[model samples]
Every structure is written in structure tokens, then in C-alpha cells.
Target chain A: MQPQRIAVVGAGAVGSYFGMRLAEAGHDVRFLMRRDYDAVKSGGLHLSSHLGDLSLEAATVERTPEALAAHGPVDWVLVGLKATAIPDIPKLVGPLLSEGTRVLAIMNGLSVDEEIAAELPAGTSLFGGLGFIGVIRGEPGQILHQEFGAINLGHHGDDPHELQRGVDLFAGSKVEIRPEASLLKARWEKLCWNIPFNGLCVIAGGVPVDQVIEDPPLYDAAHELIKEIVAAGNADLEAHGQSARIDGPRIAHLFLTQTLGMGAYRPSTVIDYNNGRPLELDAIFRQPVQRASQLGIGVPMMSMVASLVGKLGERVE
Target chain B: MQPQRIAVVGAGAVGSYFGMRLAEAGHDVRFLMRRDYDAVKSGGLHLSSHLGDLSLEAATVERTPEALAAHGPVDWVLVGLKATAIPDIPKLVGPLLSEGTRVLAIMNGLSVDEEIAAELPAGTSLFGGLGFIGVIRGEPGQILHQEFGAINLGHHGDDPHELQRGVDLFAGSKVEIRPEASLLKARWEKLCWNIPFNGLCVIAGGVPVDQVIEDPPLYDAAHELIKEIVAAGNADLEAHGQSARIDGPRIAHLFLTQTLGMGAYRPSTVIDYNNGRPLELDAIFRQPVQRASQLGIGVPMMSMVASLVGKLGERVE
Candidate 1:
């Protein structure tokens, strides 16, 4: 596999963790950041993780897209921003993409690929990447990885070469990357866990994942929400002549057991909400629920949580 | 109408406010208090209302049910405690009842009449009263009436005289009392507002009713919840051979407009959850959703809110 030049936009926890992994894999990884640019530039980037503590002593950091673009078009532009930062994507990443540059989004929620696809130059190959990791930004230029470090990557069309390219990008890294056949199905499958856990965490006043799992009623609520997401996902798949990949009971059990082992880890949504920052409500909640509604599928639980989280996001703003 | 003796068994806001009104109406109103005993005994009960300001100087206050029972079989026992205080009802208010005594529960939630009925002496006449008033106990003995002073009273059995007797007690008071033929139906009707406004207020992290109404998504969420409550209410009513009284859109409109005028009133459930007091979860949320589930009616919104609020209550404790 050939090493690629990668530019990471919105280098927060997700961005820094993955970019650091790519840099460790011997790729020339550049990070375009806003808040933590100075810290990352001076101190480099550090990841204290269960796998191993690693640091990039002198990482390439840029404060703006103009500075990142000055280095010429990169092979892979990894968009790792929160969904709330979607509006800033066109301005931030448009100039950093070349004709052959493929963009991979390590973010949450459904239709994220399409949303970013619309913002980028036409014919730019897009890959959807779902990060199932429990990592947090502890301090400036530092990350604390609690548990899980796996990414599911899938391309726009049925091209195994394109999918393998995304997988091969993390070849010698600590993070696991698995190529998926259907990006849409993978996103909806991810939503099976994200919709309930993240939304419930915020709606329940920023309660941690373990607290939600330990409480029987909240657990039952989470189970019901997971089932609703699965139902909506399967319905959407069937409508598109695709077989269902999400099993409600199976995924719910997996999430509960996994989250129980996660201790008191707070989800990113809860952290953003607690800090009075804008929630990724549109990408994580509203888009999927609205799409389900448009398909004439009922998602009462998701609808309720979406409206609530949306209002909560507005309140914080 | 003959003047009768009335004993208020829970001297919180609901207890004190109505107890003060009955005392002003020249009825022999006695309060069986716990936390506010000394405050009421020394300071008396003061009510500042839009209609008029009133106070009771040297009012009858009892520290125990035995003390209240010593007054000899009160004509009416008003069980005005929070539903969390229900388990103590058999011990606290059981001694205060006599053969001819009628119990009127001015409380929130459904099946409350049945809960109190099981605890009280058999063959005692029972009535359910839903308070639409916006009154809060500011201090120990002082109550602030915000707006809307109306109570819907309904008897257990179909008897006009029993309903009229319940109405006649508040004849000289400043509240509007309407008698309904069915207590069960009335409880469900109040839940159309309670399940949404009260439940959403807590679920949205203690957002005030005015804020909930002002925000579009929250209001939409509240509207959807109201519709679910109405659907569940009508289904329950139809199964019981009763017609529906809750009009979803109409009640939603009324609540929104009325709440717009309510300024920043916090619902009682929000208050209870905020103060770390035990929420009236079983009566207000769990029972209704369970009943709806048992009847094969879907109440996804209520189930989610109830579970979230229930967990929230547990966390606070």
C-alpha cells in the first residue's frame, strides 16, 4: 500500500486521535484546527490510550484552510468535525481537495456523507466513517482514550478498490478500520447505538452512559429507542431494495453490555450540552428522523428526542 | 349548603392554598401538617392571589393524624399531599376519616382516587379533584397564586347529589369548581396537559412552561406528546364504554395560549425533580403509560419521557 498525504479538518478529539494514528502509520498528516492549533503546534499531539501512550512531537498544524491549501492538494481530506460544524465545511475544506482526493468523515449520525458531499466539489469520492471509540480531549493537544478504537469505513458505490483504499489508510495504526459494503446501511446501523445513547444522555440532563444502563427504566427506554431506530432503518433499507443489517434486540444487548463496561463515560453530545456548546442535533437526530418521516415510517421515540435535543441546543445558543 | 368540617392531610402548596380558601369560606378547616406545622401555627397561612389577598390568623393545625382525629371524625378529609407521600397515606390520613367523611384528593396524575380508596376506610365516599390553579408555596406558610384558579371535581359513582355536595363546599370561594360524572376520565383529561407540559419541562432540563411554548421544536414535541396522551385517553375511555372528551388540537391550543400568559411558571413535576424530592412518577407517568401499553395502545412519547424523568428522579435521590 502506498502512503498518502492526509489533511484533518476540525482537529478536536476525533480529528486528533485519527490524524495521530495516520501520522504514526508513516503518512504525512496535517491538521487544520481552530481552538487547539497553538497548543498542538507547540506541544505536538498526544494520545494517552489503553493501547499505548503515543505522541507526535512535531505535527503539521494549520490555523486556516488557506494555510493547509498552500501545501498543495492532499490525497485524503479527513473531515472530523462535529455535525454542528457542517455549515463551515465548504469554506474550510473546499480548497484542500484535489481532483483525486477522497474525503472520509469520521463523525456521527446519518446522511453526513451526503451533506458533506453536497458541500464539496462535484465528483469528489466520499467515504462514510463511523468512529465507535470512547475518547475525550483531556487538555490542550492531549486526548484520553477510554475504550474502543474501531472505525467502519464504506465508500459511495460498490467498488472494492475504493473501500480497500480507506481500510489500507490505517494499515499500521493502532486503530482498527473495517470496510463496510453499504455506507447507508452502516450509518443507519451506527444510529442504532448513537440515536438512543447520545440523545438519552442529553435528554436526561447529561447523565453518563453507565448511569443510563444501570437504571432499569432508563435502560428500558434506551432499548425501546434502539428498537425504533432499527425499525426505521430496516424500513428504509427495504424501501431501497436492500436487506436489513440491523437487529434491534441484538444491537440493544450489545450496547447495554458494552456501555456497562464503559463505566461513567459521558458521550460527546452530553459533554457539548454541559459546556453550553451547540449540539450536533441536525446531523445526529433531525436528519434521520426527518428522512424516516419522509419515507412514511413512524419513529415516535426518535422524533421526541430530536425535538427535545434540538430545543435544548437552541437554549444553549 | 351546610357548613362542614374539612381536614387537609398534606400541607404543601396544594394543601395550604385550598385549605386557606376553605377556611375563608367559613368552614371548619383543620390542617394535618408535618414540615410546615410550626410555620402555620405561628405565622398562620397567608395567600396572595390575583382575586384578593387573604390570611388565616391562629388557624387549626395538627402535628399528627391522632391530633387531627381528636377533633372527631371530620366531615371532609382533603388529601392534598404529593403522590410520593401516598404510602404514608394509610397511616397519616387513615385515622382522620369517619363513616360520613368524604375524601377529595386535589392532586396530580391518574388512578390516585383508587390508590387513596384502597388505603382509606371501606365504604367512604371518594372524589377526585384536578387543580388547574398556578399557586406555589414560597415560604413555610405563604402561598403565591400566579393565575388560573379552577378545580374539576368528579365522584366515584354516578350520583348528582354527591357531585353537587363536592361543588357546594367551594361555593363561597374564589375558585371555579366543575363537577364531572367520571373521575377516571377527568384524570386522563388532565394528563393530556400534565404528561406533555409537566413531562417536557423536566425532560428539557427544567425548562419553564413559557420557554417550552416559545421554542418551536419543544412546542412541537409538546404538541405530539399531547396528541399521544389524547389518543391513549380516548382508547382507554372507549374500552371502558365512555366517549372521549380530550380534543388534542384544541387542548393543545388552549394550553399553549394559556401558558403564554403564564409567564415563566415551572410545572410541579419540574419543581419536585429540581428540589431532589421524590417525583410523582408512578401516578403521573408509569401507571398511565403501562395502562396504555396493556390496552395495546402505543404511547412512545410518554414512555420515553416517563422513563427519562423516572431515572432523573432516582438520580436526584
Candidate 2:
């Protein structure tokens, strides 16, 4: 396949990492960023990982969506923007998308699909994405990917073939893209595992997961709470007839292990909190809570967690 | 009746206020304190309020429990020790309780009575106390009453007649003993009001009461949580078959008003949290939560607050 031109939106850790790798692999990649542009222009987007530090000297870094139009059209637009930044999506991405352009959203919440679907040009191909890389910003125009995995992508609708061109583009590089059997199921499965653990760690100021898991009462409460998220997500997926599937105990075990394994790394919510940056609390916590409420699932712990993190975000403002 | 000789334990705010008042009224008084004696012996004790400042040159201060014996026995002992120093209660009052030395506890929380009761000699009069004065250590051997109101003291258990001496001794002073049908109810009432507001304000690094109360959802939750406390307290009283006469709605109203009126006065918990001092978390919050659980009352919000505060305490430590 000819190397497709890609515009990576919100060039923070994850977006920058994938963009850098694609550019290094000789694909035409452009990073859409604001403050990071000067640094990227100077250093050409250096990425350090446990694997190795890689630099993308050929990648073009642009500041605005209008500037991306100046570079002409792109085949794919990958959005890794923070959910709080979603309201600005239509404004930011409008100039970059054509009718044939595929939009892939890799974020940490259940609302990413709806948010992107609302902002993108009508009839544009939509590929749902979830990135499992443990990435952090090392400096301006520099990021650290401590762990690497396939950037999972799925077609938003029942047509599995909808995302083959974009998937092939990523497969041509070092990144992997698995066609999800059911995108809704995949999204909810991610939510079932991600939201509770993230919320818990962030609100408790990132107490080591091992320590929290040791406490039987908190542990049990957490498991039940995660199950609530799972149930809610499953219900939502089932409503769409998207074949909901989540191994509850396995996900719980994974949460415990991941927490213990990465005890030192601050979660994304904690990072946002520490940086005085706007958090994706509404998208990540409140949106799911609203969904659970709509489905009439009693998610007491989820609601409590949402309220606390929401109040915390409000206090920061 | 002869002027009752009073022993003031922990010559801090509450102790010095009442102790100095009684001493000025021509009642014999001795203060049992650690560093208070040296300061008092050198310059006497300075008592200041909006009313006036008095240098009590005649008031004696003892540095230790043993020194209290050297100063001679007294008829009444007012224990004003910090709840953190509760373990020293027995030793502080040991020298003063020769025969009829009645004990009055003017501290935060409900465990003070049980803590001191276990240590007091059998047949000695025991009374519960609540001070409405907002006082603190102004300087060495100096106490300042920022806000002044009448005190409440009465017997906790049987023998309502046991508090007459307290009433008589506090005569002519601002201290007024409310003849409560049950002192335990009064203590619990104070605890119910203190836990949420105090902990929230303190843990937010001394954000004044107004900040927490001004927060819409938090303010409402705080008000409701206090009602839960009142309900829990009543349950406790009913379990003992004591009079559960505290008006929950009225108390909640008083607390909301108190928070608004406090303006910039940071609660002691906030001060302690800021200074890395040992917090009264377990005493004020955890104890009540435990009590609630024993009573089979659901206090999810209170328990969450307690857990968060407990975690904050651990972080600062």
C-alpha cells in the first residue's frame, strides 16, 4: 500500500508517539499541536521509550487546522485529544477532513465515539481506537513510551471492512490495528476496566494498588464497583446488540496487576490534576455515570467517585 | 458554700479561660501543665478577651501531675487536654482527686468521658462538658478567647445532683451549665457538626468553612451528612435509653450558619493538617463512623469523607 498521509491531532504523549513511529517508518505524518510546535520544529519530535529513543526528522509539525489545509488533504486523521478538548473538535478538525478521510479516535472514555461522530464530516469513515501504551510527556516535543502495544482500531459500525485502509496503513508501520468484532463491545469492555481503577487511583491520590487491594473491604467494594461499570457497559452494548463480552474476574485481576506493576506512574487524571490542566472528568466519569443512570443501573460507588473527582476538578478551576 | 478549689488540666485555651475566671472570682485554682508552669511562674498567666485582659498573678501552675499533689488537693478538676493527650488523663488528675475532686471534660469528641471515666477513682463525681468559646494559645502563658459564649456541663450518667457544685463554682462567670437530660447527647451533637466541615476545610489545606459551604453539591451533601450524624447519635442514645432530644434540623441550621459566620477562622483540624500536627481524624470522624456502623445506619458519605481524610493524613505523615 502507498504510505497514506496522516494528521495526528492533539499531539500529546500517545498521539506524538504513534506519529513519530509512523514518520520514522517513512510514512507521511503531520502532528497538529500548539505549544509543542516550536519544540518539534527545533528537535523534530524526539521520542524516548524503554525500547529506545527514536527521532522523527521527516515528520511535519503544524500548529493549526487551517495550516493543515495549507498542506493539502490527508488520507487519515487520528485524534488523541483530551475529552475536555472535544468541544473544540469541530473547529480544530474541520479543515483537515475530506469525505474520504477516516477519523480514528484513541482516548480513555466511552464518549469518544459520540464526540467524534458529532464533529466529523458527514459520511466520513469512523474508526474507533484504544491505545494501550504507557506514555508520558518527557519534555516539549519529547515523550516517553514506557510500554508499547498495538493501537487497537475498530470500524464504528457493523461493517468490519470499513477500516481496512487505515488498518493497513498502521500495519505497514510498527503499530498494530486489530479489527474489533464489535466496536461497541470493545469500547465498553475498555470502560469497564479503565474508569473505576482510574477514578479510584486518581481520587485517592494514587495510593499503590497493591496496598489498596490488600484491604479486603475496599478491595471488595472496588470489585463490585467495577462490576457495576461492566454491567452498565454491557447493558449499553447489549442495547445496540453489539455482543457485549467482558471476563469480570479476569479484568479485576488485570486491574490489580496493572496497578501494582505501574505503582509509580501517575494516571492520566492525576497528571491533569497536578498540571492545573482541565481534566476529562466529564467524559470519563460523568458520561459513564449518566449512561448507567439512563440504563437504571445502581452504580453507587461509581457515582461517589464521579462526584469526588468532579468536585476536585471544580476546585482546581 | 465555700469557694471550691479547682484544678485545671492541660492549661491551654479552655482550661485557662475557665481556670482564670474562677481564680479571679476568688476561687482557689491550680493548673496542671507541662511547659505552662515555667511560663506562669515567670510572668503569671495572661488572659485576654474582647471583654478585657487580666494578668492572674495569684494563679499557680504545676508542670506535672506529681507537681499538682505538691500544690495541694482541689475540689474540682477541669480537664482541657487535647484529645491526642488522652492517655495522660489519669496521671494529670491523680494528684487532685483526694476525695471529692469532681472531673469536667471540655474537649472535642465523645470518647473523652469513657477515656477519663476508666481512669478516675470510683465514687468521684464525673461530668461532661462543652465549651462554646473559640479560644487558642495566644502566647506563652497567654490565652485568647476569640469568641466567647457560655459553657455547658452536667453529669453523664445517674445522679443529676452531681453537677450542682459545678453550677455553683461557675457562678458569676460566663460558664453556664445546661441541665441537659443527657450530656452524651450534647457531646454527640457537637461531634455530628464538627466531623464533616472541619475535615473538609482542613484537608483542603485550610480553605475556610465558607469555601466548602459555598460549593453547591458539597454544601448540600455536608448538610445531609450532618443529619445522618444526628440520626446516628440519636440511635446511640436510644440504644442506651437516654433522652435523644437534640433537634437535628435545628442543629444542621446552626452548623450552616456557623460555617457562614466563621468567615476566615480556620478550624483546628485545618490548622493541624497544615502544620503536619497529629490530626484528630480517628477521634472526630472514624469513631462516629464506627458508631454509625454499630447502629446499623448507612453513612456512605461520612465514611467516604473519613476514608479520604484518613488517606490525606497518611500522605502528610
Candidate 3:
């Protein structure tokens, strides 16, 4: 297979980690950073991961998409920006995409691809990916990989070959990549964990996963939240002519067991909230809740959590 | 009517304000304080209210219920301790109660009467009072009445005369005293406001009432929470062979409008949680939530809020 030229837009934690992985896999990877442009450009990118530590001494870096695209039309523009950054995507990444360039969003939350799709030029191929990794940007040019790292990838359109191509990008990497036929299903499945853990952690005032799980009532509430999200997600899937992909009890048990082994992890949203950064409320919370509402599903827990985190985000902003 | 003897146990804010009111009404009101005993004993009790300012020069104060009881069996023991202090009530106020001495709990939350009932002697007529007042202890011996000052009093057993006697204590005072047939109904109604504002305020990191209301989403969540609490309350009332008295929309509108006029008020639970004091979780949050669960009423919003606030309270304690 020919090595693909990839532009990593918004190279923060998720972007830099995956971009480095792709770079290590011998792909021509370039990073587009905003605030940490100077630091990343000077020092390159570093990843301290459970799998293994990685350092890139001389990697392609850019301050903007225009700068990234100035060289040539890249094969793929891998977006790693927080979902809160969705509004700026069309204008920022419009200049970066050619007709055949596929934009893969390695971001968390539902309806993210749709939001990005609304802004992109018509016929711009989009692939949605949910990164189930506990990765954080410790500092400029530094990424801390806490625990589980996996990517569930699926093309927005029904193109098996296209999905396979996206999957092949991470063929030999240690990071697990699962290709799915339905991106929406994948998104909903991921929300089974995100909605409860991320939402509750922030709602509980930025406590760790262990603390939230250890408290009996809170743990019970977490399960209740997960159940509500699953119900809503299934309702949404049914609306979209798809079957339920998330099993509440099974998924909740899996999350609890897995999270227990992951140690005391502070979710991305919690970290974002505590650091006074913009939360990915629209993508991770509001969009999914709105979709669930449109489908006539009641997600009171999610709605409340969304309201709380959204308000907290506003206060900080 | 003869002036009755009253013991104001746990005279923090609600106790001091009402105790002073009864005293001003020419009743023999004695205060039993814990933390502010020295200051209050030295400076007496000061109440700054919308209706009028009150300064007591020679207030009868005691540090313990035994000391207060040493004078005699008081006609009324107005218990104003935080709901978290319920465990100490049986031990603290046990000696203060006699056959005819009625205990009026001016504290907040549900099943408070039951908790107190468990610890008190059999047939010790209990009157539960919900203080709808926005009074706070600004400092030792100082009570700042922010806005509305009303108390809804109801008897635990079938005794209208018992309830009226409790109401008659504040007959001529500025504090509006309302007599209800059912204390449980009143408790649940008060929770409609408490669960949303107090729970969310603390959950949102000690945000004020106005801030919670000003944010559109938070305001909506507050309304949703009130609706759930009303549903649960009605369910609880129905379980007790009573009909629903609390209208979700009407009561919610009343609370929102009244809160708007009250400016920014930091609720007692929020203050307690922020100041590292015990939250009235069992009575305020857990009891009602448990009642809802028992009746198979799905109060997802309340459950989540309860869990969040309950966890925060635990962390602080």
C-alpha cells in the first residue's frame, strides 16, 4: 500500500498521539497546531504512553491549515480538535481539503461528523472515529496516555473500500483500531461510557473515576445515567432504521470493570472543565441529547448533565 | 392567648430569627446554641429583616439542651439544626421534650420528622415546619433576612389543634406562618425548590440562585428537576392516601418568580457544603429519592442531582 500524506489538524492530545502513531507507521504526517505551535515546532511531539514512549525529533508542523496545505493536497486531514472547535472547522479546513481528501474526525461525541459535514464543501468525504483513549496534553509538545487507547473508525458514506483504506492507516500500530459499518452505532456505543463517566465526573466537581465509582449512591446513579443514555441511543438508532447496539447492563459492567483497572482517571471533559478550557458540550452532550429528544426519547439525566456542564463551561468562558 | 415558653435549639439562622420574633411577640424564648453560644451570649441576638430590624439586649441563651431544660419543660422546642445534625437530635433534644412539649422542626427536607420521630419518645407530638425564609447567619449573633420569611407548619398526627398551636406562636410576628393538614405534602413541596436550587447550586460549584436561573439551560434543568420532584412528591402523597397539592408548573413558576425577586441567595445546603459542613442529604435528597424509587417513579433528574450533591456532601464531611 502507498503511504498516505496526512495532515493532523488541531494536534493536541488525540491528534498528536495518532499523528505520531501514523508517523511511526511510516506515513508522511504533518501537525497543525494553534496555541502550542511554537513549542511543538521547536521541540517536536512527544508521547508518554502505557504502550510505549515515543519522541519525534523532526516532524512536519504547521500553524494553520493553509500552511499545512501550502505544500500539496493531503490524502487525509485527521481532525483532533475538541468538539467545541467545530464552528471554525469549515473556514479553517476548507482550504486544506481537495476533492479526494478524506477528513477523519478522531473526536469524542455524537453528531460531530454531521457538524463538520455541514461546514465542509459538498462531496467532501468524511470518516467519524471515536478515540477510546485516556490521553491528555500535559504541556505543549507533550502527550500523556493514561490507559486504554483504541480507535473505532467508520466512513460516513456506505463505502467498504473507503472504510478499509481508513482502517489500513493503522495496520501495524499497537493501538487497536476497529472498523465499523455504522459510525452512528459506534458513536452511540462510545456514549454508553462517555455520557456517564465524563458528565458525572464534571458534575461531581472534577472528581476521579475511582471516587465516583467508589461512592455507592453515585455509582448507582452512574449506572442509571448509562441506562438512560442507552435507552436514548437505542431510540435514536431505531429512528435511523438501525437496531440497538448498546446493552445497558452489559456495557455498564464492562465500563466499570475496565475503568477499575484503569486506575484513577480524570476524563477529558472533567480536565477541560477544571482547566477552564471550552468543554465539548455541543458534540459530547447537547447534540446527542437533541437527537434523542427529536426521536421522542426522554434523557433527563443526560439533559441535566448537559445543562450543568454547559453552564459551567459558560461561566468559565 | 398566654405567652408560651419556647426553647430555640440550634439557633443558627432560622432559629435565631424566629426565636427573636417570638420573643418580640412577648413570649419567653430561650435559645440553645452550640457554635455561637459565646458570641450570642455576649452580644445577644441581632436580626436584620425586610419587615423590621430586631436587637435583643437580654436574650435567654443556653449552650446545651439540658441547660435549657433545667429551667423547665418548655412549651415548644424549636429545633433549627441543619438536617445533617439529626443523629445528634435524640441525644441533644431528648431531655428537652415532655408529654405536652411539641417539637417544631423549622429545618428543610423530607422525612425529617420521621428521623426525629425515631429518636424521640413515643407520642411526642411532632410538628414539621418548612421555613420558606431566605435568612442566613451572617456572623455570630447576626441573622440577615434576605427576602421572603414564611413557615409552613403541619402536625405529624391527626391533630389540627396541635398544628394551630404551633402557628399561633408566630401569630402577631412578621414571619408568615401557614398551617397545613399534611406535613409530608409540605416537605415534598419545599423539596421542589430545595432539590433544584440547593442541589444544583452546590453541584455547579456553589453558584447563586440568580446565576442558576440566568443561564437558560440551567434554568430549564431547574424546572425539569422541579417537575420530577413534584411527580415524586405526588406519588409519595398518593402512597399515603392523599392527593397531590403541589402543581408542577404553578409551583415552579412561583419559585422562579419568587427567586427572581430574592436576588442571589446561597441556599443552606450550598453554604454547608461549601463551608465543609455536613449536608442534609438523608432528609433533603436521599429520603425523597428513595421514596420515589420505592413507588417506581423514575426521577432521573432528581436521582442524578441527589447523587451529585450527596457525593459532594460526603467529600466535604
Candidate 4:
């Protein structure tokens, strides 16, 4: 496959790490840095992964999307910003997009691609990616990748050719890319883990995921949250005229078992909360909660969890 | 009303404060001190109340119920220990009770009188009191009473004369006594306030009642907890062949409104949780949750709150 030119937006842990991975795979990848802009600009971006370390030169780092756009139309625009930053999608991506540039929103929450798609020109190839990874932003210019860098890639548009390209972009990288048939389905599946762990870690007093697992009521809420997400997801899939239904019990059991092995690892939201940064509540909790409610699913714990997490944020705002 | 001889079992904030009030009213109030046994026995028991300050002599403080019982059978035994201490009632009160001695359980949580009465000799006069006040243990020998000091007295058995005698005991004190006609109904009413405030305070990260109110999701859980308690209480009343029902909507509104006025007051459970003392989970949360579940009501939030609060306790235990 030809090395494609790619631009990375919201280059936090997810974006920077993946972008650096694809860069090592020989893609022409450049990052849009904000908080780490100065550090990365001077020292370049670094990804410390157990899989292998990768480094990008200072020339590959840009402070603004307009500066990143100077290279002209790229083959793909990879969005790794928080769902909370979705509103900035248009202005941020507009200067970086070409008529043929495919946008991949590798975000945690639901409907991110749709939101990004709405911001772009019509017929702009778009897709979604859900990274199941344990990674966090270290100091400026570095991302510490602990484990699992697999992304479930699914196209939002009807272009099968572009979806394959989304997978092929990570071909030689350590990150495994599983191209999914349905973006909505994959997003909901990710939410089965995200909503509970992310929201609960913050709600359970900034504890790690394993602390939540050890705590029975929190564990119960986590199980219920997963079950509700699966139910809501399956209902959503059926509503979207899709045939496959995500299994609720299996997902609950699986997530609970998986969470027990998290071994006191804190989720991203808790990290964000501890650092006093804005959470990705809208995409992660609010959107999914709204969809579940609309589907007539009973989501009392999930709703309460969302509201409580939102309260934690609304205090400052 | 003539001065009555009374023994105060559990000289924490509620017990010591109210006991001191009754002592000032000329009642011969003797107290059983545990944690503060040495300090109180040496320096005497003190109540610093906004209403008025009262202090008891060293002679009035006893280290054990046996020592308290040594003064012959008291006319009244005020069981002010937490519901978590219910199991000890038999051993503690057994030495304090005489045939004519009536037990007034001024404790929080459900079915205290029943639990006490069951452990006592058959036909032991047992009644319950619910104190609506703001009080806390300040030091070894002192209790800080910040606000209201009122007791809602009700007989667990069918004894009108004993109930009035219970009321008359607090006749000259600052503590206003409102003798409720039904213990069950009064317990349920108190629960409308207790279930939400106490449980939520602990579950909301050991914050005050006011903080729980300000937090939307915690507040939502609080409101839902109150609603579930009201429904459960009403159901329990009906199941027990009582004609009257505790109004759910009214209780919810009244408690939520009243809670907002609490002004950062931390409930007892939160205090216990912070102090590493046992919470009154079995009586306050577990019993009510079980009863509610048995009544075919959906108490998801209430149930979860109970489990979470319980988890907060179970960690150390």
C-alpha cells in the first residue's frame, strides 16, 4: 500500500500514539498539539509503548490546523480529541480537509463521527474508530502506552473502499486494526465498557477501575451499566435496521471479568477529573443515555451516573 | 410531671445532648459512656447547645450498663445507641430494665423498638423516639447541639398511659416532645428524611447533606431514595393492616425542601464513615431495601445507594 499523508487532530494520548505508530509504518503523519504544543514543537512528540517506542521529529508537530493544512489535502484526518471537544470539530478539521480526505474519529463516545461528518463538506469520506487501549498523556510531548492498542474501525459513509483504507493505514504498526461492519454497533460495544468504567471511576471518588470492581455497589452499577448499554445498543441496532444484536449477559460478564483484571488502573475520565480537565461526558454518557431512553430502555443507574459525572463538571462551569 | 429516674445508654451526640437536657429538667439522668467513659466519668458530661448549655456531674456518668443498673431499676431507659448497636441492646438493657421501666429507643433506623422488645423479657414496655435535631459529639465529654431538639415519641405496643409517661419525662426540658399515635407510621416518616440524607451523605463521598443537594446526580439519587422509602413505608403500613398511607410525593417534596435548608450539615452515617465507626446499615438501609424489594417495588437507586454505602463500610470490616 502507498504511504498516505495523514493529519492528527486532538493529539492527546490516543491521537499522538496512533499517529506515531502510523508514522513508523511510513505514513506522512503530522500532529496538531495544544497543551504540549511548545514542548512537542521544540522536542518532538514521543510515544513510550511496551509494544515499542516511536518518535516523531519536531517538523511533524504543528500548533494549528491551518499550519498543518499547508501541506495541502491529506489522505486521512485522524481525530483523537475528547468528545467534549466535538464542537470545535468544524474549525479544527476544516483547514486540514481535502475533497477526498477521509476523516476517522477515534473517539470514546457515541455519534462522534456523525457530529464530525456534519461539520465537514457533504460527500467527505468519514468513518469512526474505537481504540481499546490503556494509554495516558504523560508530561508534555509524551504519551505512555501501557497495553492493548487495537482499534475497531468502521465507516460512517457507504464507502467500503475507504473503510478498508482505514484498516490498511495501520498495516505494519503494532496497533491491530479490526475493520467493523457497523460503526454504531462498534461504538455501542465500546460504550459498554466506557460508560461504566469512565463515569464510575470519577463517581466512585477518583478511584481506579479495580477499586470500583472491588466495591460491590459500584461493581453492581458497573454490571448494570454494561447490561443497559448492551440492551440499548441492541435496541439501537434494531432501530437502525441492523440484524445483529449485542448480547447483554455476555457483555456484562465479560466486562466485569475484564475489569477485575484492570488491577487498580484508573480510566481516562478519572485521570481527566483528577487533573481538573473537562470530561468527554456528552459523547460517553449523555448521548448514549439519551439514545437508551429514547429506545425505552430502563437506565436508572446509567442516568444517575451520567448526571453525577456531569455535576462534577458543572461545578466549575 | 415529677422528676423521673432515667438511664442514657450510648452517650454520643444525640444521647448525651438529649440526656443532658432531661437532666437539666430535673430528671435523674445517668449516662453509659463508652469512648468518652474516662473523660466523661472524670470531667462530667457536657452539652453545648445553642438553646442552652447543660453539664452533668461525674456521678451521673457510668462506664457500664451494669454500673448504670446498680442504681436500682430506672423509671426510663433511653436507648440512644445507633441501630448498628441493636444486637447489644439485650446485654446492655437487660441490666437496666425493670418490669415498670419503659424503654424509649431514641435511635435512628427502622424497627428498633421491635428489635429491642424482641430481645427484652416478654411484655417489656418498649417505645421508640425519633429526634429531629442537629447534634454531634464534640469531645470526650461534650456534645455540640447546633439546632432543633425535639423528639417524636411513639409506643411500639398498645399502651397509651406508658406513651404519655414517655412524653411527660421530657416535660420541663428544652426538648419538645410530640407523642406520635403510631410508632410504625412515625418510623416511616423519619425514614423519608433519614434514608436520603444519611445514605446520600456517605455515598456522595462523605460530603454534607447540603453538598448532596447541590450535586444533581447525588441529589437525583437522594430524591429517588426518598421516593422509594416512602413507597416502601406505605406498602409496609398497608401490609401490616394499617388503613392510612404515608404520602410519597408530599414526603419527597418536604424532605428535599427541608434538606436544602440543612446548610452543609453532614448526616450521622457520613460522620460514622469518616470516623471509621460502623454505619447503621442493617437497620437504616438494608432492612428498608429488603422490605421495599419484598413489596414488589422498583427501588433501583435506593438499593444501589444501600449497597454503595454498605460497601463503604465493608471495606475495612
Interface RMSD of each: 3.3, 3.9, 2.9, 3.7
lDDT of 3 at A40: 73
Q: List the residue pairs that clash in candidate 1.
A: none
Error of 3 at B33 (Å): 4.7
Query: Best-fitting candidate, measured by TM-score?
Result: 3
Candidate 3, residues B52-168: lDDT per residue as tens digits?
A: 999987788888778888988788888998887888988788888877888888888787888888988898888888999888887888889887888988988737888878877
Task: For model 2 chain A, give the 10-residue run with minimal summed lDDT.
Answer: A208-217
Kept native contacts, fraction for each prediction: 0.51, 0.05, 0.49, 0.21
Mind giving the per-residue lDDT tens digits that candidate 4 earns over A1-317? 79999999988888888888888888899888889989988888788888988777654877889988987678889999888788898889989987788888888888888888778899988889889889988888888998678998998953578888887778887789988888888889899998888877776566778867886656777887888888889999999998867778877887788788878688888888888888887889899989988999877778878876776666424
The stretch of ten residues in a row with the least summed lDDT in candidate 1 chain B is B242-251
Error (Å) of candidate 4 at residue A2 is: 1.9
1 or 2: which has the higher lDDT?
1
Best by DockQ: 3
- Interface root-mean-square deviation of model 1 in angstroms is 3.3
Docking class of 1: acceptable
Per-residue lDDT of model 4, residues B1-317, tens digit only: 88889898977788888888888888888888889989877788777878977777654777788888887779888888888778898888889888788888888777777888888889878889999998988878878887677898898874788888887888778889988877887898898788878876766567678777876656777777777788888888888887767777887888788788879798888888888888888888888888887888777667777766766677535
Residue-level lDDT of model 3, residues A84-169, one tens digit each, is: 88998976788888879989998888988888899888898899888888888888888898887899898887478899988888
Error of 3 at B76 (Å): 3.4
- The true-versus-predicted C-alpha distance at residue B6 of model 4, in Å, is 1.3
- Tens-digit lDDT track for model 2 on A1-317? 78778899988998888887777677788889887788888777888777567987656878888987789799888888888888888888888988688788788788678777877777878887878677888778778887655666777774656767656777656676776767776776666545655665556654544444554445555676778888887778767766657667787777656655764556677677777777788777888889888988877667766766776677667
DockQ of each: 0.36, 0.18, 0.37, 0.23
Which residue pairs in model 2 clash with each other? none
Q: Which ten residues in a row have the lowest lDDT in candidate 1 chain A?
A: A240-249
What would the per-residue lDDT of candidate 1 be over residues A1-317, giving only the tens digit for each residue? 67789999988888888988888889999999877888988998899998888999898899999999998779999988888778788898888987799898898878777778888888888888899998889888898888899998888764678898888888998889878888878888888778778888888878788877776666777787788888888878788787646767787888878888988889998999899988888878988888888888877667877877876788888
